[model samples]
Target chain A: MRDRIIEIIGTHGKNQGALIPVLKAVQRMNPRQYIPQEASQLVARIMGLRESEVYEVVSFYGEFSETPRAEHVIKICDSTVCRVNHHRELVDILEHTLGIRVGEASRDGKFFLEYSPCFGACDVAPALRIDDKVYGNLDRDKLEAILEAYRR
Target chain B: MKKNVALITENFHHYIPPDLAGYKHFGGFTALKKALALSEEDLIERIEDSGLRGRGGAAYPTGKKMRQSKAYQDDIKYLICNADEGEPGTFKDRDLLEQDPFGVLEGMVITAYAVGATHGILYLREEYAHLLELLQGAMAAMRREGLLGQGILGTALDFDMTIFSGAGAYICGEGTSLIESMEGRPGRPRNKPPYTKAQGLYLKPTLVSNVETFSAITAIVKHPQGVFTGYGTQKSPGTKLISLCGNVNNPGTYEVPFGLTLEEIITELGHGVAGDKGIKFVQVGGISGPLLPRACLKMPLTYEDFDAEGLSIGSGAVLVVDEDTDILDFLDAVAAFFKHESCGKCTPCREGNRQLMNILKRMREGTALPSDPENIQRIAHTMKYASFCGLGKTAPTALLSAIKYCPEEIFMRRGQ
Candidate 1:
């Protein structure tokens, strides 16, 4: 993870304008990992700065998570396209079953739910993400049935 | 779309012809010829007489802006075409730029002529990098055809336009902030009174019109009586270009006459909600317009209609929500956006929007105490009234409107 962060940051680090995208690439070094404490430290070290300095950039952005997500990550798309389709039923079922709400990992630590805006898929209304996978045209029963397998 | 027909989209309003041939077909730029024959004052009066309002959220009349812009005594005045449409759900301007670049260019050129501008600047959003190339192409074509630069269309209007891209700051959509950004300042907004029309870009009097507002000028200029007579009520005349996204059958931009009801527009043009979906809420006008509950969906999409509903039409950005979405989560995400976008220039927005996210995040996590909902309302209400700039002032409008109509939906379990 440390070497990968250096490589990504080192490759495009000279361009100040590339900061946002570079930081994003560094953040995604561990795809399944959420916000790790050392991630900021590593970012600071890679960028030749203090840990608190890198932490500022991480905390500033809404997309960067501070911790690792659950085994199954579910982001319901509330973007312009998805809103037209309606994902409330699926969100509700996930909330009820996982015993967690949006932007959170379940108490059992198996699933995470978050809201995302505009995934550029207005054609298929009501979109969702499981781990990194996107699903569309969801119904509540199917959402629960899909989640049952992720639980184990 | 009409027994009274309308064409407002790339799908519908496509292949618009240009030049004398195209102009005659669509009745183009006749207003310019007439206005040129008359005086600038007469041109301004023609527009004010038509009762055309600004499409960029302020609802200020366009003719008034032109008159005020004309009042400035700068040797070099400017017409800044605000294509940096940073609003989240709004794409009406994008469509206008894509489908009818000439019409949009003509509006800016004529507007510059009226305002006595020699140079024009289009502050386009960086995301639409392709549009930068498109607009430049159009300008090059205009210049080659002698429609741009000195003595345009054989008139004294010597106007040339250049395009500039914004570096990912949403607050730059505010006219003042846009000027500041162009002057190479950080995109944080400034207080008004030294309004943009009076002392804008580089301390010269400037006129900033939304891309959609500029496009509407062509239609108005084409037919003087058509401007006043054809569409909308007397107060708010002319058609609106709506950016319709989400679960509609035809999810695209539609240019329709004003005063159409939400139900009428959604049902006829939006093709109604898919499946058995009943709309839970509609966030009218991008991020700032009120979050209209399902009940108000029947209201007309006019200025008066939203005014009656205690909402504003904002900039024709309609985000449709169906029965099953989580309102709390939606608020959380919105609050988070405002918080993230806060330029840190003022406390009401900087601190206020940040706190909004906290309360929302808490509510989402079930850590919010009993009085949390009330506190949430209090902060939002304060932000609405007290904030310094448009960013802080309208920051909480979506949340506030959401809470007003869907009082329980803001809190989980409470709404249930």
Candidate 2:
């Protein structure tokens, strides 16, 4: 892990502007999908910056998480377009299917459901993003089928 | 009479993914070739004559902005394409990149030549992560064809581009805030005076424009003079790509000339409200844009017309709301968005959003005092005048417009 982090930093260089991309690459490589305390400290030392600065960057953006996240993060659209299209019902179905409320990972560590601002998928209202793929115009069956595929 | 005008979107359906040959077959890089032959001053003047404005809400003259950057004497000036299309109810940029990536790239190269910029960066949002491979392939193809990197098409110009992904911050759509985020800090807006053209990315003379704006430049340079300006009204020339969403029956991206009324856009283009529902009101532009009642639909979709009614054609997102949805419920969603997306840098925005959300919540619960509406107005005005950035200043746009346009529907719910 240490060597990999160093290699990532080397590829992007030790510039301050390269911090976000480096951290993103590090977090994506982690098994738990988060930047652990040790990784942040190591990044700080190598980049010649304070540990707090690294942690602040991690905590500030919605994408980065310090603690462990589920293997797949389910981000439901909660903006005006989706809400007008009744995204609340989508949230209800998501919470019931996953058997965990929003902001919580499933007991088996498979899924974590949360809300995201509109991601320019408004054409298909009531959309959700799992990993990099976006699914929209959802109903109960479609939602269940999507989660089933991810669960497998 | 024509519902769709295909200028930037002319070859949208023809090209396959990353098909450089197909893009050329449809007359793609010919504009760059023509632009390369002209002096920088002539190119800028032609763009100015076309009357093309910034497509990303502000509507500043694109040619004027390019001329301003050209005045500065910098060895390493940067041209940053703001692809951070985080605006709610907007997906036109995503469509353009997906269908016509080469047009956008061609525009970037032409703009770089005009401004004498060596480095170009496409600030893509994280949500559009799926398009990364396609863009990379397109750039690689451009390089192979001598369209990008070190002496483009046997010219002395040398320019290159790279993609930088934003980590989900709507405020980063602001020019300075986007630059700040690129600098690896928290995505917060900086004080303006040395605007982005003077001192931008890495404190250099950088020119930041939206993805659609770059594509428009490509279109303007492609055709003969007065041909591109033939569409739309006298003040606002050329076509606009509108992301029509919400309760519209046919919700999608449409490229329309600027003279059509909102009613025509909603009815003829969008196929009217979904499920045959009656119209309640429309939110022109994105979430930050003002909400207009049905009566205002008669106004044409021009910058001058919208400006006359104290509204701007921001982002070209026309979000139609049906009569089935309540106005206050809609405002709640709008309030929640600002509260969540605020960078919390300044007091007026950070605290003002919290207060606005609280008051909206109380009003929804029917627990408001008579002073609540007045208080909401006061807080909104304060945030408008005092907030540090565009996010805070325009945060209360929807709420204030609700009060102004739909006062009876909103205050009646309070039984006042």
Model 2 alpha-carbon miss at residue B376, Å: 1.5
lDDT of 1 by residue, B314-409 (tens): 888777777766777677667777876787888888899988888877777778778877887788778877787888888888888877787777
- Tens-place lDDT per residue, model 1, A1-152, is 77777788777663333444556565556655455778667766666666675565455443456777766667676654454355666677778888888878887777778875443234345666674455656687777777886765
DockQ for every model comes to 0.11, 0.85
Off by over 4 Å in 2: B414-416
- Candidate 1: list runs displaced more than 4 Å: A1-152, B1-31, B412-416
For model 2, the local distance difference test gives: 0.91
lDDT of 1 at B267: 79
Give the TM-score of chain A, superposed on the true chain A, for all candidates in the order listed. 0.71, 0.94
Cα displacement (Å) at residue B121, model 2: 0.2
lDDT of 2 by residue, B310-376 (tens): 8888999999999999888899989999999999999999999999999988888888778998999
